[model samples]
Target: MKIKVLGCSAGIGDSRRTSCCLLDADILLDVGTGAGELSLEGLIGINHVFLTHAHLDHAGLLPLVADAAGRFRDRPVIVHALAETVAALRECMFNWRLWPDYAALPSLERPFLRYEAVEVGATLSLGGRKITPLPARHAVPAVGYWIDSGQASLALSGDTTLCEEFWDALSRIENLKYLLIETAFLNADAALAAVAGHMTADLLAAGLSRLRRPVEVYVTHLEPGWEDRIMAEIGAACAGFDVRRLRQGMEFEF
Candidate 1:
């Protein structure tokens, strides 16, 4: 499986972009402003989107992408998320006032977007990948994804705090090669990170100690301007793992 980091910043400013990832060619993990950087061809090829939560930084471009791709692709974009996350999206984002409900646009029966309310611990097959949604700690309904493509498995800690269930799910995946975890704040903002359900460098180190298997860890979702500080903190705290910051446009084949 090829994973592309379309955007990895916790928030947007300067050169930083919010969370968004492209899995292979057809699947999108989030639709943040980073998605706007994709080529038109990239936009049209996305057949599925698995959102972690309903935060604007994570799902800002969903409706626009569905609408833009509607003209080129005949099929609707399948948006998979937890039930409450879907509800939040409907009530906040897809409401007729904010954007056209593409879930019912073009036609009620055949729309450009569809929502699949995925439950925690449930695994679903999408194309060649098996996706398992895991419970996450956040201000709103959230979930992390465990993706296995028959070769290597990966755990994505969608914006979350140090949660036991998240670690438990990670421990269950065999041959887990990569962990795209989030570190949204610096150590100085530990309190803020906790309240916002985000991980700081120190918090992430504590979480890593619970893992039994060795994995290449790529830290993402950093608040802009503190990337250097957060990266240094992660390196200082965890020396046993190959930990690095995620960069936009970086593509990895695993």
Candidate 2:
């Protein structure tokens, strides 16, 4: 399996793209602004989207992608997300007022998009890979994903704070190679990080201290302007682990 970092910034700015990842070539981790970087052919080839939450940065491009793809093909793009997140998308994003309802476009039976409500802790298989939705702590309903493809597995923390279940679930998986966790703020923003259900350098370090096994940890979703400071702080805090900051266009093959 190959995981490509489309964007890993906390907010959009020059040289910063929102959080999004591509699994192999068919699956998307989140359809954030980074998705806009994909070519028209790449966009049409995407078959499934596993959304982390309903936040605009995490799911902002759904409507546009669906609309563009719908016009070029007859296939439906499956959006797999938590029920609440799915509901929120319909109510806030895909509503006719905000954007045309792709779920009802073309025809009800042959719509351009399909929403699949995934349950936390459940694993679904597709295209020879297993996608497990792990519960995540966020302002909105969210989940981390453990994607297993025969010989290798990768875990993504999505956007979350310290949580026992996330660690416990990861421990149960064998041969886990990489952990794509979030570090949305610097240590100075610890208070804001906590209230926003995001992790800071200090908190992420303390949280990872409990892990029983070590994995290659690549932190993502950092505030663009503080990337260097945040990376240095996280490095100091997680000195014992193989931790690094995720950069756009970086690729991981497992």
Candidate 2 vs. true structure, TM-score: 0.97
lDDT of 2 by residue, 130-201 (tens): 899997888777899998887878999999987778888888888788899999888888778877988888
Question: Against the unseen true structure, what C-alpha lDDT does each candidate score?
Answer: 0.88, 0.87
RMSD of 2: 1.0
lDDT of 1 by residue, 45-154 (tens): 99999999999988998987887788788888999998898999999888899998888888887889999999999999977789999878987789999889889988
Model 2: CA > 4 A from native: none
How many steric overlaps does candidate 2 have? Answer: 0
TM-score per prediction, in order, is 0.97, 0.97
Q: Give the best candidate by TM-score.
A: 2
